[model samples]
Target: MMGHAHALSGIVGWMAVVPLLDGHEFFGLRFDLGPGEIVAGSLVCAGAALIPDLDAKSSTITQTYGVVTRGLSAAFNWIFGGHRNGTHSLLFALLMGGLTQALALWSELAVQIFVFLLLGIAFNGLGLGNDKNRLASEVINAMGTAAVTLALYASGVNYAWIGVAVAFGCLLHFAGDMATELGVPLLWPASKYRFGRNIGFTTDGKVERNIVTPGLTIAILLLSFYLFPWPELLPQA
Candidate 1:
């Protein structure tokens, strides 16, 4: 389900408001990240959003996350006993967060970049970003990622080094999911990991459910830009 909507969720991660809940700020100050920033942030965001799907048996994202998904599925069935049980826990989340933050620190990235990259990928796992995307639509997602990444660059973020760091954030996410069968590679090295072969769930009600949230999310993401009265909130950056 990769498409314009997936791009938007990744873009939203650029807002960098999560850590603010704990009263911390990135870049030594708190300022609104304009759509440009959001666009740049979406690069890693898009990768992370879909990171959890790596467990699917034939998924391309899974294959791209690390090693080819074909051989790894066997190892997964043996470990953790199942997919949803092991890989999606808070333990892995912390590992991912720490790894991304470490990369950012190693690369001297701003805290904002580290957090948003994690946000973008996680949101996709919640079943929101790519209801419209498929294997062939990767560049569509990449463009979405680049839009946010470049926006940060244009805003004087010096993303030249941070870009590699962001990719590592994506790598951490993909690798974490590799511990499960539903993993994805996120389009790197043409390979990825997985933890399961199937959840035994049917597609019977998926269409109806997907039409609700994914569709609504798309509407909001778009209206926030093209339709919503944005200037009233903060001045359209």
Candidate 2:
């Protein structure tokens, strides 16, 4: 699937679960997902949704941070057995979730830096800037990412569930890929089988561009209405 499709699925997926997760406790973690958390999780998930594609040098994720991401891309490609291999598996999700959770537990500064990086990836995946103009787009994306990260920081958004969000986002990416012709290898090393292969529409093709992307966009809008307190947030005329 395309980058935007994966990113959009992440946003929609997180928003879809906000209601069920809010004010609930699961596995000893409290999910008090207020407005700030909802927004932060959405973006974090969106960023993570693009992670599996990091093995591909030309992927949106690899291009997001230039040298830093390019180096990571090279490393992931080697460590994970190339694109769509180990990184697309459940194991990868678990590992990433564990590491992110550990980081969150270890140091506040580290987690903040991680969030900033993820938000940058999210903005890039969401197609926030002009593709034709590279320089302008990077500037816009950087400024937007910084502004949003700072805003969420100022809002005191607790990231206790960031690990779950990251793992779930990867699953969402797998789901999106499964909907494409070349499915992801969810089982990975254990079984080199591609689930949903040859059964779905082509990636970035007509169905995806016209139906899937638009559908996701609409879903985001609808979910936003259902999840947020619009009446309270908006000013009365």
Candidate 3:
């Protein structure tokens, strides 16, 4: 799937899980999410949906951070043995989730500094400023994103939920790739089996653009309507 497709899938994936997390149990565990948690979780899930593609420099996730992500992408390709290898595995998802959780637990200053650095890289990658004012623009964008993140954190959003959202996003990415010709290695290092094996349309194909993307979008809208407390807004007759 392409970048837009992956993003849409991320949102749909989050919505698909919302009902399960709200009033149902999965693997013998249930999640009782509040409204704030649901919003935070969905946003994080959508953002993290691009993480798996970080191994490809031209990918949206890498392009967001431009040259900053180039090195990281190269390193991931090297260690994971190219795209759809280790990074697409369940193990990688778990590691990413753990790392996100740890970072979310850091002190306010630490979190701010981390977000600033990440946003700086992202802004620079996106060509926000020319050589003359690049540094200034990077600082401004980084600070802005960091401030927003901090405000959300202070507004009763749970950090653990953010980590889980990211993990689930990656899972959805892997699932989406499973439909492609080059499937994902869900269990890498230990098992060399690639799942999904030519199950869907090619990446960025007409079918994907016209069919799958629209289908997922409709699904998301319907799920949102069903899961959200719409009855509260109904008029008393």
Candidate 4:
């Protein structure tokens, strides 16, 4: 799915986790970012949410992730056993998280970049979806969620509940990626289960289900009133 489409659909798909997370608001994790920073963080989170689609190569969004990510993704796919290896694995997410923390300790700027970018990768891992490797996928998602929430709180949105909401919301992005037509390597190093990632279309966002993303995203944002109660005043999701 494209960013806009992913933005919309992700909210709905990740909703599945609501039951697992219970009443906790996972995606609303607020960071201390000023309006600008919050915008950046949200964008980063959304981008992270979309990272898993790069493998398809046919996807415009995936191609846009850049040659480094794309090349590395391809190489990783070859070495780690497609969606079932390093990229989709929890071990990988931890590795990335640990790396992010270490980098964060290096400098404030580094922390922000690492936090956002690494979270993106972790989100991609989570969105890999029901790929027989749910364990790996969940681990990555957990780590990604923690990293994102920590950043949110550390940045300034200190409410722990908000962090939970942030985690839940971001995971929804990953899940949304599942419904795409290509596939998400949700689990790595254990199972190669390609999650949803199919909005009726195959590549290029030309599928029938693509029509559902906008409505789905709006629905999710609306549902957040009862579920999260966060103030997303932008009115421009």
Clashing pairs in 3: none
Worst 10 residues of 4 by lDDT: 157-166
Q: Model 1 over residues 32-80: C-alpha lDDT tens digits?
A: 3444433344445555544333444544344443454445544543452
RMSD of 2: 1.0
Each candidate's number of clashing pairs is 41, 0, 0, 42
User: How many clashes in candidate 1?
Assistant: 41
Query: What count of clashes does model 3 give?
Result: 0
lDDT: worst 10-residue window of model 2: 175-184
Compose the digit string of candidate 4's lDDT tens values, residues 14-111.
Answer: 34344444444334532332333433334344454554444455543344336767786686567656542344444454454444445544666655
Mind giving the per-residue lDDT tens digits that candidate 2 earns over 35-147?
89999999999999999999999999999999999999999999999988999999999999999999999998898999999999999999998489999999999999999
Quote the RMSD, in angstroms, for model 4.
11.3
When 1 and 4 are scored with TM-score, the better candidate is 4
Q: Which ranking of candidates, highest lDDT first?
A: 2, 3, 4, 1
lDDT of 3 by residue, 89-194 (tens): 9999998877876787766455445444443333333334425675676566666656656666677554445467778888988988887676788889899898
Candidate 1: residue 182 lDDT (0-100): 37
Per-candidate TM-scores read: 0.47, 0.97, 0.76, 0.48
**Candidate 2 or 1, higher TM-score:** 2
Query: If both were scored by TM-score, which would come out higher, candidate 2 or candidate 3?
Result: 2
Candidate 3, position 61, lDDT: 67
